[model samples]
Target: LRILCNYAFNYLNIHKIYCKTDNQYAARLYEKVGFSHEGTLHEHAFHYGKYIDKFVYGLLSRDYLKK
Candidate 1:
């Protein structure tokens, strides 16, 4: 995750990276890797037999460089 962020910010020159997930574990992993919780979309996606909330996380180039 760190390597990917480094490449995106340094080589690709991306201003920001966004990730969306419905799993708590993934959300925690993103946070541990420097992503900030931006927002949530309630009942955004359907999985299995029910709708679930979607979590949005973001990391900016400047923020990524600070790590």
Candidate 2:
């Protein structure tokens, strides 16, 4: 994740990056890497048989550079 962020911000010249996950641990992992908790999408993704809530995380170039 860090590598991707570095490349995105440094080489790709990305302004912002966002990701969504249905797992709580994954969301925390993103937060640990400087991503902010943007929002939660209620029942936004479908799994085996039902819809699940997805957590959104985002990081901006400025924020990534500060790390």
Candidate 3:
């Protein structure tokens, strides 16, 4: 994932990236990839017959470049 992010930020020249994921597993992965939690939308998504919170994660190209 880190390699992929590097390629996207470098070769692709993307300045910012955003993602929405379930509250559980995505936290660690996002942190590992240097993405910060921007915010959460309460009950913004529905899955398995229930509403779930969606977390917003983002990373900036400049910040990734410094690593």
Candidate 4:
């Protein structure tokens, strides 16, 4: 994932990179790559007959460039 983010920021020349996950472990992993908790969509999805929360995470290209 870090490799992908690097390519997206460096080669693709994107302005921002984002990720959304319902799992806490995945969120922590994204945080390691400079993504931050941008927002959350409460109960936006359903799983196993129950509503699930969606977490949004993002990082800006300028921030990456500064690193």
Candidate 5:
């Protein structure tokens, strides 16, 4: 996933990428690839008839370059 993210960032000339996912598994994967928790949108998402918080994670090119 890190490799894919790197490729995407490079391909798009993006300096940063932010991700929002409710899947805990994906969230953990994102963190493993260097995404840090930026903030959360409280009750910003609706799932299973209830509102759930959405976690915002981001990674910058500089941060990835440091790795």
Candidate 6:
């Protein structure tokens, strides 16, 4: 994740990275890696037999560089 983010920010000149997930573990990982909650999509996906809420996360290039 660190390598990817750095490559994109430094070489590719990407501004930010976005991630979406319904699991707390994944969300926490994103946060640990410098992303912050951007928003949520209510009932964004249908799982087994119910709808699942998805969260959007974002990490800005400046913020990523700071880490």
The candidate that wins on lDDT is 1
Report the C-alpha lDDT of model 3 over 2-67, residue by residue, as the tens digit: 988888999999999889888567788998879999999999988999999989999999988998
The estimated TM-scores of all candidates read 0.94, 0.92, 0.91, 0.93, 0.86, 0.92
In candidate 1, position 37 carries an lDDT of: 100
Q: Scored by CA lDDT, what does every candidate get?
A: 0.95, 0.93, 0.89, 0.90, 0.87, 0.93
Candidate 4, residues 1-67, lDDT tens digits: the string is 8788889989999999888899999999989878889999999999999999999999999987787
Provide the lowest-lDDT 10-residue window in model 6: 27-36
- Single out the weakest 10-residue window by summed lDDT for candidate 3: 22-31
Q: How far is candidate 6 from the true structure (C-alpha RMSD, Å)?
A: 0.9
List candidate 1 segments past 4 Å from native.
none
Q: After superposition, how far is residue 62 of candidate 5 from its true place, in Å?
A: 0.6
Error of model 2, residue 17, in angstroms: 0.6
Ranking by TM-score: 1, 4, 2, 6, 3, 5
Residue lDDT tens for model 2, 2-55: 999999999999999999999888988999999999999999988999999999
Model 5 scores a C-alpha lDDT of 0.87
Candidate ordering by lDDT (highest first): 1, 6, 2, 4, 3, 5
Candidate 1 clash total?
Answer: 0
Instruction: Estimate, for each residue in 1-67, the C-alpha lDDT of model 6 and write its tens digit.
Output: 8789899999999998998899999999889888999999999999999999999999999999987
Q: Which runs in model 6 stand beyond 4 Å of their true positions? A: none
The TM-score obtained by model 3 is: 0.91
TM-score (C-alpha, index-matched) for candidate 2: 0.92
Tens digit of per-residue lDDT, candidate 1, span 14-59 = 9999999998999999999999999999999989999999999999
Our model 3 lands, by Cα RMSD against the true structure, at: 1.0
- Comparison by lDDT, 1 against 4, better one: 1
